[model samples]
Target: MHSPTKRHALPKSNVPAVQPTPATTTDLTGFTPADSSLRGLVGGTPVLRVSQPFTSPDRGFWAKLEGFNPGGIKDRPGLHMVERARARGDLLPGAPIVESTSGTLGLGLALAGMVHGHPVTLVTDPGLEPSMTRLLTAYGATVDMVPAPHPTGGWQQARRDRVTELLARQPGAWCPDQYGNPDNVAAYTPLALELAAQLGHIDVLVCSVGTGGHSAGVSRVLRQLYPGMRLVGVDTVGSTIFGQPARTRLMRGLGSSIYPRNVAYEHFSEVHWIAPAESVWACRQLASSHYATGGWSVGAVALVAGWLARTLPRDTRIAAIFPDGPQRYLETVYNDEYCAEHGLLGVRPGPEPELIGRPDEKEVTRWTRCTEIADPLAPTVRTESIEGGRAR
Candidate 1:
């Protein structure tokens, strides 16, 4: 499927006002949304459309310079969620902003907290990137490390429980509750707008589904412009979002055991399951080829995006979202030895993987193994999820 160009230019009546002009408008040409970097942070990112030998040039696959942000693509929603919450009176004065972030959201909350003068508390399990924990801590947010349980209820649920308890203890504590917060969905609206502006038009958006915040919000807005738009929900095989049996996951920030109400599954045209090993390897490949520092989820999305870029028709324009930058994943996915030892180094090296793609290869995968794509209409919550590797 191909992206259709805007038949008419957006008139002055319907355009966002540019960010306040600085005293000296030196080299800044484009705009960076408060949430993401369409235009990168000072000297950090540049918007460029790459032409790769592996994909069709006319189709023009574009990736925003998210790594250019202080964090990455998820920064868009991360900041948006907090700013919106404050504007809506969801946050109270002197109340700590609380959330269970595997990574990027915490950074977003940190940035937003700094801008607005509030304290942020992050509750995460051991599987998260140490760098992310440090990044948030460096931003002055309190980090509470919750130990993951064996077999299930690993740090994910623990963090959730921790947030609940913390809120109870501190009156007026504002738990952003990213997983279910509608603001999470709303945060991506501007991102969708940016995508439309940068890419001209986007036919299919292949993105990693974590809290489903990025996908739900971006896809909804894009749909209005491109009704034929296809939103491919890419979840790690261990995540429970799409009625899958829960399993242990290594990739953080991109998958969840719970189907958050914020994740609007109905907007999707289809779902493509991703494996953690594939994600890690693809991430490394991205660095080598594109010179871009891909995040954990970016590597996963890139793996699938590469597939769509190469195999899809010449007319198809595919836009993919890579939420966080690679800096956070230095110890895990981006490490070569880590990839090799985890059996995620390459495409199995040999046999043709069955249609299921060898879910047994990794002890830690993104989603549960039992999910099938047949029921696209299942209830978002009742469909299935596992707090402890249980997808029910």
Candidate 2:
């Protein structure tokens, strides 16, 4: 298990610590910050205690700063999957890797490819941010952008199809189908252990569901340690992950038009769908008060986590996973112009959660839930996920 370096330690004053940077010009001092290996820096991310804006009793809620990982939370799974594949002899030495990702997982795959001596090809749609594109290319991974969305299943399915085409063209290519691969779910064991070490006892686990990888992986391990812990799955309003109708989602990384097979829906005690406006409000509030924030999913998870902290018992310990940093979302979630353009700014947070009783229900526009948990796509559509059993 890879243990991340300790970080996000708070000062006695309760103010966010300011990290010192080297001067513009190098001083004559021989002293240097220690950083031995790129792979060594992968895990051991800090768990930050959120202070302001959350007045709930006890440790209000802890934000696991996955952004501290070089490539964010997905990095854990990405590296784990690659290492496991190589160990199992499924990925031959020096074989090229191919996969479909929006950004976070793409970054993780790029890092994994780099560490494992494999070339990487990431297939994504045009919706991918420019900064992510450059970063992936900088990591020596080839970026393949599908020109358009699929008429039926939308961009995600199109990207998967493109991955198939690319794999056919490049012989001996390995595609880590993050959506269905069980390895994706197994990749976060170390993370769960880290959380156990950090908090000791976690009463509530709030996570944003994307490919349903981290939520399923980490929550499973945590549940073993804290059997009474409640797993709260957060998602965007348009996401179909929680049986909500699939529509155009402004937020990335948490919602999927196509239901991912990796979602351990049964593990989730309850689910919440946050709109873009609500996420914007939460992200900005976190930024101004706590000086910590991320993208849409981060904000969504934080919103739900904060609510859990406030509504639950005073002793309840909630841990929310923040997948990455805010730099990538500067032009979107953090940008005033972009938020205004999308009418996502200054929206009041959360209306109410409506009880859901059936899977075929419609017009779910706000927070919604159902007592039962099952895959909405189970009987209707057969998934095109490659590597059905492996964790990637």
Candidate 3:
């Protein structure tokens, strides 16, 4: 493996910038867009044009189809992180890069490794998507499973510990540390620009806030483009996102046990606390009724986007970032029996009621350090259900 010097991406500016489409005065058949540019991946993927008025009403409602990527939305950050590091002379041509991911980042890393001729090692827990494991392996990267769930163990902590172990063993281990790594958010800035070009103008942006990487990174840029842009950050009801006790749930990729420095909550104009059941139901709703397939995070995001669609102005361009594709969740989220076994069954099938749209101001909702769950900074957070009926 090549031993490249450690390099960091530049700090992201909150200033708004719009992404401009390729302006061509003449058409040339058999001409392809320029290669070697990340922006090329931005809008070429499928974007659904919503016809129905948001059950409530946003300025306008649409979803960016990030699942079209070879992996998923996280790939945007995954590729950028590795490439930027290499450009800055941080990653040697064949250096073995290490990272902790739920699954999405691993996909992105694999792509990066193949393109740059590098080796990628992923530190993940057993709680990951079954298909995700296969996808990473198919991409030709090494998948190292962390400690199983213990009496008080967690997958997040376990993965982080593996990263620490790898760093201690490997001479030049570079952990993206998505939680604190600014590049995680910085890599997503282009998404905001793409949406601006796609929607013409955005009045409200709906997305789930986990490590705050996607929301913070994208919202900062979107808010800058449209100063009046209303950014809605969605969190699960039992999530520690707003600095509360961690709640066990089925949704993945959104909400965190600790306050990630990369997430910029200040960029959000509003926040919605959706329950796990709601997210599961939303995922089903998207697939069964809307004819669109999405995973847990996308479903959680759609729950908020659906609500915002019905409440905000009709012309307001509402774009929600849909992370991974549904192919990875066939045995879990896509399984009705699996969902019924989980607490996610509680979310009913009735029409979505008129939500106040305003968040609970009296509620304690601020990003803060987590003690209720394991240390987020630590390499892993072993997962266990309070219901203990079956363990992962």
Name the top TM-score candidate: 2
What is the RMSD of candidate 3? 18.2
TM-score of each: 0.77, 0.85, 0.77
Per-prediction CA RMSD (Å): 13.9, 13.1, 18.2
TM-score of 1: 0.77
The Cα local distance difference test for each model comes to 0.67, 0.82, 0.69
Expressed as tens digits, the lDDT of each residue in 1-392 for candidate 2 is 99998898765797787999877986769774666667788778889888557554354799999988887889988988898889988899999999999899988889898888999999998888898899899999999999988887789999999999998998888988999999999999989999999999988888989899999999899989987777878888877776777788788888998989999876777677778888888889889988878888888888778776776667778899999888889989998998999998778675345666554466566555544555785653221111121111
Candidate 3 lDDT tens digits, 1-392: 99999899989989888889898788688787686354355334566754333363223358888888878888888888887888888887777899888887788888888877888899887778777888799999889987664232256666777788897898776767888878888888777777778877877777877778888887888878887776667776556665445645456777765567776644555456666676677777677655766887887778667665765556656788887678888888877788788756666533443333123223332221111222334454332221121112
What lDDT is reached at residue 317 by model 3? 68
Question: Any idea what lDDT model 3 has?
Answer: 0.69
What ranges in model 1 sit over 4 Å off? 1-60, 150-152, 346-392
Off by over 4 Å in 2: 1-35, 56-59, 351-355, 378-392
